[model samples]
Target: MSDGERVEATPIDPPQPLGATGEWLASCREEVARVAAGFQAFEISDEAGYRDAKRQRAALRAEVASIEERRKSMTRAIELAVREFKDGAAEAVAPLSGLDAEYKERIDEWDEACRARRRDELEAAYAEMAPQLVTLVPFERLAGRYADAGKWFLRSTTGPKAMASLEEAVSDVARNERQIGMYGLAPEEAEAMRAEYFSTLDLQAAARHAMELREQRERVRALDAERAEAAGAPPAEESRAVASARRAAEAFIERDAQAPALEERQRYVFEFELSADELMSLMRFVRANGIHGRRRRAA
Candidate 1:
């Protein structure tokens, strides 16, 4: 075909009749059949033919959609009738909602009473297990710690099973607390272990951590002592003081030796106060250098 010429489309048959809107549907189908029979098929020799084919296809689709909308409109009376029936049924049952809630509340009240009885029984059993543990930590405090751990007071849990679970928890805590106390740690160290136990709930791990810290401190001190001994001196700070004192004494002696034969060794006295550390350093230097010095206590 030429660019301006259109080809004829082969017509497709309409769908079969269905539902209560059959006659109306048949009429709609006949309209679709008539439109389909007249549809011109266009070869895309140019943009104009493509545009005409697109517009015609869209118009066919819109006709079918209008038919569907009318079919839906035919069902609106039936839909409204069903909705009104449901609303009447709902109105008839509306007053029963409060009665239903009341029945549920009554059942819940009985359940709660049963639960309260179970809770009392559990607490009594706990009281019996608590006395031995009370010396280490208060029973109330221990109870509070494990309060949220289990649903022991529920009707589903048997009395003996709940008792056993609670007893185990209480016993474990008491045992850990006693073990920590028996370690005989310093007050601050004990406090740290308690904090660790509270945070992690693992007594053995906390004890191990404390021991590791102690070992590290001991190793550091031992290394420092060995280093000081190898140098034939006190600790680092005291050794520095001793070296300073020795240097000052040597400088004085050298200055005295160069003092032009100082009138047949005349006596010179120097007086000054020294801190405990400085005094000890001065005495150590004097002894090591074998310098004779007189000791006098101030009256």
Candidate 2:
């Protein structure tokens, strides 16, 4: 056809199918239903039962703390025993010190590993809980919308009435959007959902969240290792040993003092007097770090 006589080309068919809007809305509704189901399973409520669950969680945390404290005490005791054995003047203490040294080393190693594992477990739990929390409000709203829709559908009859009901359904859809908007869903989630409503079924955002959680878990694990090593070390008593050594050295200059030289007195201070304090400090440090002091062997 001549350019001037050419008919204007018909507009290319739209990329999406006819009725795509309705299909998208339907998919959104299904997602809303899925989320609602999950929330229902979660059994979340601001009721007395939820309060009781919180109390139970608190109690469990307290018990975990107690167990951790006991472990620290045990570690400290072992460290003290070792220090005393090493510095005690008597030959009888040497064997006991050796045993304590071995025990302390083993326990510290195990504690480090356990601390890492605990951190990982807690990280995973926190990550899982985060997404669920985000979904809660949206799901609740969706559940309410579905209920209203079901009620409206049952009593409606005429075309005008059905159109009114459809408008209500549109409002319900808008409400869902508003509810989810508060979560600040990752841009990717919004983009994917916008591109294809069916993409909501994919949990890529949740997986990304899980990966971030794992990174945090590893960071915590490394920190725990450093703290555990520091706690396991002999306390300030090492400095006290040197001070005692110096004092004993000066004693030789004063005839009336009659104290032995640094070498001889150093053993007495480190082994007999400071061991208990060193052990106590170590125990307190470990407990503060939330490391379980007790060795739990694999069954």
Candidate 3:
């Protein structure tokens, strides 16, 4: 009687929380309302407003599509730019001559400038289209916290412990963004940070280079195998000598072609003034030891 009476005296409220899809739908509805309001507010007599409304409607329709063609195009452009810069760097400094030095500097400067400019342009473009993009989805379903009050209530009811950590992570991102904006970093700095971030995500030029190198290595292995099959056995001394000479000639040609670009790249790396030699040495060590492939056994 005591427990039943106490429970009856204190009525429990039913839990109400918005799920991910619910949040998205809410956001989508909010976006549609906002856009509708904005369109309504436009002066009917003004030709500019009429044009703007038409353009915005078209953009909103595009946003309704699951795939964003414009964003995909921009991302592809950035990827291409990165690839071009990398290839240019690779081609600039093989022989390590003074001419190569100048070329290296020019290439590096141009590449860095291009990256900064491109990133800024992309950011601006995104900002202009953001409103339309928002309208494409319901707000509640955007896949982040703070979309609706129901999410908070749900978290509080179901997983109270995780609420603090989630809030902290969101706070951390906000703090970082605030710091970045406050610092007013140079375009070059911003671009560098962007590149670093993408690199961490395995989306950078170096990652592409690594893949290309692996493909080249595979081709070389295939050629070696084909040669072995055709030859059937070890060649006589004279033939072996001829094959050695041929290999040496090919190596010399390859080195000659690669030298200028490598030297230029080295100079650019050195310009950073951050122990470029040591870094290159480490890179070579990693390649020679196959560190990327497997862990080495202790000698």
Task: Name the top TM-score candidate.
Answer: 1
* Candidate 1 Cα misplacement greater than 4 A, ranges: 1-41, 46-55, 68-90, 132-150, 179-185, 195-299
The C-alpha lDDT values of all candidates are 0.70, 0.48, 0.45
The sequence of per-residue lDDT tens digits that candidate 3 reaches over residues 148-245 is: 43233232333333344334434443354344444344565545443442333222343345446555665665456445535653432333434444
| lDDT tens readout by residue for model 1, 54-145 | 99989878977887787787677557656776687688778787789898999999999987886677666767777654545554455566
Q: In candidate 3, residue 5 scores what lDDT?
A: 66
Q: Compared with the true structure, what per-residue lDDT tens digits does model 2 show for residues 216-280?
A: 66566545644755667444443464456445534633543465444432222212232334334
TM-score for each of the candidates: 0.46, 0.18, 0.15
Return the top candidate by lDDT: 1
Count steric clashes of candidate 2.
Answer: 1
How high is the lDDT of residue 22 in model 1? 68
Evaluation by lDDT, superior candidate among 1 and 2: 1
Q: How accurate is candidate 2 locally (lDDT)?
A: 0.48
Q: Model 3: which ten-residue window has the lowest total lDDT?
A: 265-274
TM-score, predicted candidate 1 vs. hidden true structure: 0.46
Error of 2 at 183 (Å): 1.5
